[model samples]
Structures are given as C-alpha cells and as structure tokens.
Target chain A: MLAHYGYKDGSGDYFIIIDTDKCDGCGKCVEACAYGVMELIEDEFDIEDGSMAAVTEEHRKKIKYSCGPCKPISGERKLPCVLACSPKAISHSW
Target chain B: MITAGVDVGAKYVKVVLLEDGRKVLKRANGIVGFDILKSATEVFEKALLEAGLNHDRISRVTATGMGRKAIHKKHPLNAGEIVPEVIADAKGAYHLLPAVKTIIDVGAEEGRGVKVGEGGKVKDFVINERCAAGAGTFIETMARALEVGVEDMGPLALKATKAIPMNAQCCVFAESEVVTLIHSKVTKEDISKAIHDAMAGRIASMVLRIGVEKEVVLIGGVARNPGFLPPLKKELNTEITIPEHPQYVGAFGASLLAFETEGK
Candidate 1:
C-alpha cells in the first residue's frame, strides 16, 4: 500500500510517499527527522504485522512547509528521512 | 555599538534594540497583517524611535522568523543577515538563563523543542509547525469559541473543577469538540484546561524526542499564558524558566548576533 502524507494546494502537490508494503517500521526515519515530521504507528493495513512508519498526522496538511528545511531548493539531495529508511520505502513528490 | 534584531513571526513582528549587545535599549511588537514588510519595518522603526536613535545609529540589523526572507529581500541594505527562528530562540533563551540547556517555544503557528549545547549552539531540535492543535492558534480559536478573552484563559482554567480530556487531534475537529462541550453544559474553565492540557501533551511529546535537559526555558508569546505553563511543566515533570519579555527572546537573540557579527 502506498501511504501518502501531505496535500495538494494551489501551488503544487507536496507529498511524502511511503510504501507501507516495504516499510519494516524500524523507526530509523523517525529518529532522522529533526522536525517531528514522521512517527511510528500501528499498521492498520497490516494489523497482524505489528507497526509501520508513517508521516505524523499533524504534518500531513502542511508537508511543504514542514519539510521545507530539509528539502533542497534546487538540486536533488537525498532527504535524511529517506536515506535513513534502509528499505527505500520513502520518496517525495515536490 | 547599537544593533537591532527583527523577528517577523507568523502573527506578530517583534523588534529589539540593544546597546553594545549587553543591554536592551528598546523593544516593540506589532501585529502582522496583510503586509508583512510594512509591519516589520514599522516595528523596527518604532524600537529605534523609542530608544531615541536613528537608522544611522544602528551598526547592524539581523532578521529572523517566518517572514525573515521577505525582510531580507526588501531591505537588503538595512537587514544585514537572517537567522533561523530556532537558533534565535535558543540564543535568546540561553542569554536570559545561562544554565538553560533546553528551549521550548510555542508560537502562533508552531511549537519547537530545541536542545542547546555549550555556547548556546543548537545540538538538536524538533519543530511542530504542521499542526495548529499544538500551537497558540488552537488556544485562540478555542477561547473565541468559549467567548472568553485570550488573556483571561489562564486564570479561568486555573479554576477548572474537573478534568475533561480533549481527544480531537486536529484544530477543526477540536473546534467542533468545543462546541459539543459547550452544548453539554461543561464549564468553560474545564474546557479551557482540557484544551491547554491537550496542547501540553503534544508539546511534551516533541520535547521528549529532543530529551529535555535541566534548566528548560519556555519562550515565545504563548509562554505568557499561565494555563499552558502548569500543565506543560507537569507534562514534562520539570521546572521551566520564563524570562522577562518572553515573546521578544528571538529578536533579542538576533540583536546579540548582529552585535557579534559586526564585531567579527
């Protein structure tokens, strides 16, 4: 399942895409995110499988501004949270 | 040397003028409106006027906050540099309380937990800008719904006779919850306490992530609310320091930085 975090506004679509199927919920992203943008929660899709990493509920509405500091203004730089995810489950749609 | 710092916050613009980076000569705050540039300039000029100084007297000016970029762009000649709000807050709080190792600043649109290292450098930090529920906006909205003055929320909440939990995680949902509580005949005091407690819970979670150290200082305009303070202290299980003119801490720090940069 592609668990998407963020919203579309008049400016553009800002999303923190996480592939729940690949996320092992190791919580490395949570530790790497200095802005409290991500958190680990019980996997609702895979209830019996324990937990998974997801973008925090509060951060879903304003991902562009919330993730602004970490995101490069121009060139593509690997985000700390995405890099911390060993399973390569994280991506950003800016 | 006289230096100035301007903090263009989401809801307000704060300016602090310092003499030789040690003593605050004047400070002014103005509500931010449609024109952030105007408001920033207004507050900065006001501070300078109050200090009986002119623009020529200011050796340097540093700007910080959400609208800092705008200030920097508009007055590139006047605004010497721009600093991050978190860094400004940490610097300001550490200046007031030298022993402070942690800073928890709750502003109109954001809440931040900053862990400070020696020399007031930021070691690590966490910000909650994405949620209105954990910020001052939540309290302002709930206070309006309850028909209580914002300044009176703290004292009224102190009289809360019951502990009513506020479960709504979003501000929009929380507003509806407040309406329901009002309809259910719940006392406004209890509702206010519940709202503050909810915000405290969120702030505590962020602070915990940063690992609170001793001498925790709370800054920002929200630090003035007495209702939020007790619950926040209780949630963190530690004493908190609130400096005089808590809201201007960021600007004060920026002024100090201006002085330092000028000296360098």
Candidate 2:
C-alpha cells in the first residue's frame, strides 16, 4: 500500500509518499525526521505483520509548513527523511 | 542607508532598524494578537520613531517569521522581500558571533536547530515536529498552571533543590502531569526545572540530528530563560552563546538581508 500524506496549497502539491511494500519499518525515517512528521504505526496489510512509518495525522493538513524547514525554497531535493529510508520507500511531491 | 526588518512571531512581533547595514538604530517589540499586520506595522513604526527616522528613510524592508506573508500582503509597498526565519536567524547569529556553528531557536509555536556552514549560511536545519511541547508555549502553560509569572520561571527554577522528571511527551499530556505534580506537593521550582529539562531534551534530540558543533548559539524567546539554558547546555554537553537581544535575531537578520539585496 502506498500511503500519501499532505495537501496542495497555494504554492503547489506537497506530499510525503511512502511505499509500504518497500518499507521494512526500520524506523530510520522516524528517527531522521526532526519535525516529527513521521511516526511508527502498525501496518494493517503487512504480510510479515510489522510496524511501518507514516506521517502523523496532525501534520497532514500542514505538511507544507511542517516540512518547510527541511525543504529549501530553492535548490535540489535532499530530504533527510527520504535519504534515511534505506529501502528508498519514501518520496516527496513538491 | 537605513533598512528595516520585521519579524512577526506567533507571540511577539519584533522590528529592527539598521543603519548602513551595521549599527542597530532602534528595535521594538509588540505582542501579536488578532491583528498580526497591525502589530508588525506598530513595531516597525515604533522602531523608526525611536531612531528619529521616517518611513521614507528606510531604503528597504524585509519581513520574516510565520506571519511574513500577511505583512507582505498588506504592506506590499513597505515590505520589499520576505525570508524564512531559519535563514534570518542564521544570518543574525553569525553576524553577532562569527564562530557560531550551531543555532538553537525556541519560539512560541516552534523550535529550530540550524547548522551554519561557511559564510554563515544555513547548511542544514531541523524544526520541532508537530507538537508545542518543546517550544516556549509549553513553558508558558506550565508557568500559568503553577501561578507563577512566565518571566520568573527561569530564576525560580534555578532554586530547585531536587530534579523531578516529567514523563509526558506531549504538551497536552504534560499539562495533566503538571497538575498531578502540583497535587503531589511538588514545589513549583522543581516542577519548573523538570519542564525546562524535558523541553531541553526534545531540543537536544533535534540538534543531535545535524550534529552539535562548537560555539552553539541559542536564540529566540526561550533563550531568555535562565533555567532552560542550563539544561539545554547540559543536554547537549556544550557551552551555549546567547546574543544581547536573542529574541530579535530573526528581525536583525532580515534587516541585514534587506541591506544586502536592496536595489539588486
């Protein structure tokens, strides 16, 4: 299951997309996220039945502001949460 | 040339007037209530008046903080540009202490840790996630609960006899925990220290992400708290530097940017 969290604002669509299939729930992204945007939650459709990381509900509506500090207004994308995910399960829609 | 910077913080709006990009002519602070744009304008006009200057003397104006957009929207003619608070903080801190490599800023609604690179640029930064537990709002709430003045919490906390650990991770949960502490006869001093320590721990964790560097400067409203500083220093195992007017760093930095980017 691909979990998408975030909303489109006046700027554009800002989303943190996580591919649960590729995510092994190592919690690295949770640890790497400084804004506390992501948290470890129980994976409902997991074959192995383990926990996976997902964006916290409180930040869903304001991802643009919550994750604003990490995302530079200019320059290439190098998000810590995405980089910390070893399985490459995380991507940003900016 | 004279320039101005307006920082419309959640709790307070700060305005700084700078002359020739170096000397601070005047600074003003105003509480931000329902009208952020009005607060911003009031502070800016106050600063200019204090400096014995008029609006026409200001060559440029830069706005920052959460309410920067509103200031720009209303005063398009006055606010020439808007910059992020993180970049403004880094620039202001670096100007004060050139050796500052790490900057921790705790505001009313949020907290940020900025790692400064060469030329005082923000290399990397981290902001407190979703909760206000690690920010000044938590401390203010605890102070109100304890019936102590917010400004007095810092000095009173310094008188703690013993450390009491607050286990609540969320600000909402921490409020109940504080009430429980009060019922348990925990002294306000001890409770204050516990709150500062807990908030410091969260800030330390955020700073640890980019790694702590020497000459760490703590800015923003929380930096004024004496009790918070000791715990944050202890938590990070580092000596912290605080500028003269820590709360105005963002505005000061914005003013510096105004000086740099004017007419360009």
Candidate 3:
C-alpha cells in the first residue's frame, strides 16, 4: 500500500526532520499527513510556532508542513498549525 | 435576610444584594484598581447603601471566577468565597427556571460551560481560560476592526442578508480578516453577521463537544447579544432561557451560595 502511493525522498537524507525548537503543536501536520507519520511534540520555544511542533520518528529537524495535498484553513503555504509555530520546528523532506 | 455576591470580572465588577432571596439591588461598574479588595469593599458598600441595609444585616458573602483566589486571600475574606459563588450562580438560575440543566456563561475574557443538577448544584463544568474565542473580547475586537459599536452588533448582524467567509480560525487573526474585509468595502451588516457567525460557530463547537442538555440557560455578557442567540439556539436546537439579569449570573449564583451556607 505504501509503495502504491510512491513516497519519494525529497531534498534531504531523512524522510522527515522536525525542529523541536520551533514546533507549536497545533497538530495540523498530523491531521494533514495521510500516512500518520508526524506527531506534534511540546518544546520550550515561543518564537517557533508559539505552542507546539511536530517531530518525526527519525528526530531530524525541519520547518513547516510542505505537503502538497493538505487542505490548509487559510490556504496558507504552511498549514495554520505549522504556520502558527514561531520557532520553525516542523518539516518533512520525503 | 440580605445576602450579597461580588463578581469581580475582568471588565466589570457586578454586585448584587438579595433581600430574603430576591434581588433588591444590583449594580455593575467599570472601575480601575490593582487591589481587588478595595474595589470589592467599595462595591459592596454601594450595594448595601442602595438597599438601605447595613453590613450587619447581610447574612453571607461569596465570590467567584478568576478573581476568586485573590478575593479569598484579601482582608476579612474566607475560603468559601469561590465554591459558594459557583453554587449560587447555579442556584439563582434554578429558582428562575426549574427545568434549566445547562448554563453557558460567556464573560469578557473567558467562558464557562456549566451543568446544573437537582437542587441547583453544579454537576460538571468546563472553563475556557486558555482561549479567548468564546469571550466578549472576541466580539469587542471584531467590532473595533469592523468599525462599529459592540452594542450595535446584534441589530446590524440581524440586518445582514449574506455573510462573507472570514479566513482566520483564531480570534486575533479573525479580527485582522474583518479589517481586511472593511478595506474591500464589504457591508458593515455583513461583517457584523460574519463576526456573529464566527463567534457562534466557535462557541457552538465547544457546546457540541460537551453535549448540551435540554433547557440550556445562556448567561454572562455575551448572552445579551441579539445576534448571538439565533445561531446559538439553532445549533442547540432547544429553547434557551436568558435571565433578565444575565451579566450578574455569577454574582447571583454566589448570593445563592451564601443562602445555602446559612441554610435559608
């Protein structure tokens, strides 16, 4: 089933990278990702996403949800949950 | 038997004097003070004088809400300040409406979802202290952004034939959207209605999450809005009872708690 969707390794060595320093944890990326691969984690940073950020299993840090198919509330480039981050803690490269 | 309740809210201080369990005198004032005890004392004294009753005639006193903790620690105050206040709010509503089971208190800065049981006791409650979406401030902010008086919002919203889609999910961002709509020359009535819809939508989402019971009572400052009722009542799909003195609900409930304390 995973192979049929054709998950590509994009731009980075890791499948996903989350900067815990920047995540706000509004959980939009988790809601957006169909694969259920990302989890919002609590980190002590206000500048990233204001409250919580998404962290992947691999622990690599990235910024915002770049998923093309996700429906953002504001039609924002980043999901409102990820855009809400002040520290820039969520990103998925693959 | 004169019992009193002082609801020191974020925007206003409401004091109520109940004479033999009926409201004899009530007052709401917007005062400035860092020391709540002074304000409480001032308001209490004012209510007492207005009712032509001295402090000695008053049986009990109760306090509720965010300022409760502060009032409890102040001079000549007791621990029963907060709990009785909540109980009184529920009790007062019970006296007016025998069938009331749920109380929605949307105040200036926060909102509360209260469920009342037999004998006017609060069964379970949820306080939305972390978010400002359900509070009066949300509408106030939207009113400012839309360039209309908050008091005029309900009537203006009622006149709206269509509602524009507001983009922001949060209160702060939503206010910005209202400002942008104004720049786009959207009708004020439509903007007002949109604001009402947004607020009602947010509160409705919360109410739906908790599962509202029949005979729900809507109270606090936001309950006064005519625009708020239609959408909220539609969402509730039940008859909502709004007391004549809604803003004083927490204070009224506190007074009832005082009566309960005295077993009167």
Instruction: Please report, as a residue range, the 10-residue window in candidate 2 chain A with the lowest summed lDDT.
Output: A68-77
**Candidate No. with top TM-score:** 1
In model 1 chain B, which range of ten residues has the least summed lDDT? B69-78
Residue-by-residue lDDT tens digits, candidate 2, B114-220: 99998899999877644677689999988888889999999988999999888776677788999999999999889999989888887887677677899999999
- What local lDDT does model 2 show for residue B195? 89
Q: Which residues of candidate 1, in runs, are more than 4 Å off? A: A1-94
True contacts kept of each: 0.00, 0.00, 0.00
Report the alpha-carbon TM-score of model 1 versus the true structure.
0.76
Cand 1, B chain, TM: 0.98
Task: List where candidate 2 sits over 4 angstroms from the true fold.
Answer: A1-94
For candidate 1, the per-residue lDDT at B193 reads 95
TM-score of chain A of each: 0.91, 0.87, 0.37
Error of 2 at B130 (Å): 3.9
Q: How accurate is candidate 2 locally (lDDT)?
A: 0.86
How is the predicted docking of candidate 3 categorized under the CAPRI scheme? incorrect
DockQ score of the complex predicted as candidate 2: 0.07
lDDT per residue as tens, model 3, B1-264: 767777878777777777666755655444527887677777777777777777787777777756666777466544245653346567768877888888888888877667778877788765555456557888898888877788999999999999676645557878778878888888999998888877776566555534578779988888999999887788667788899889888787777677667764
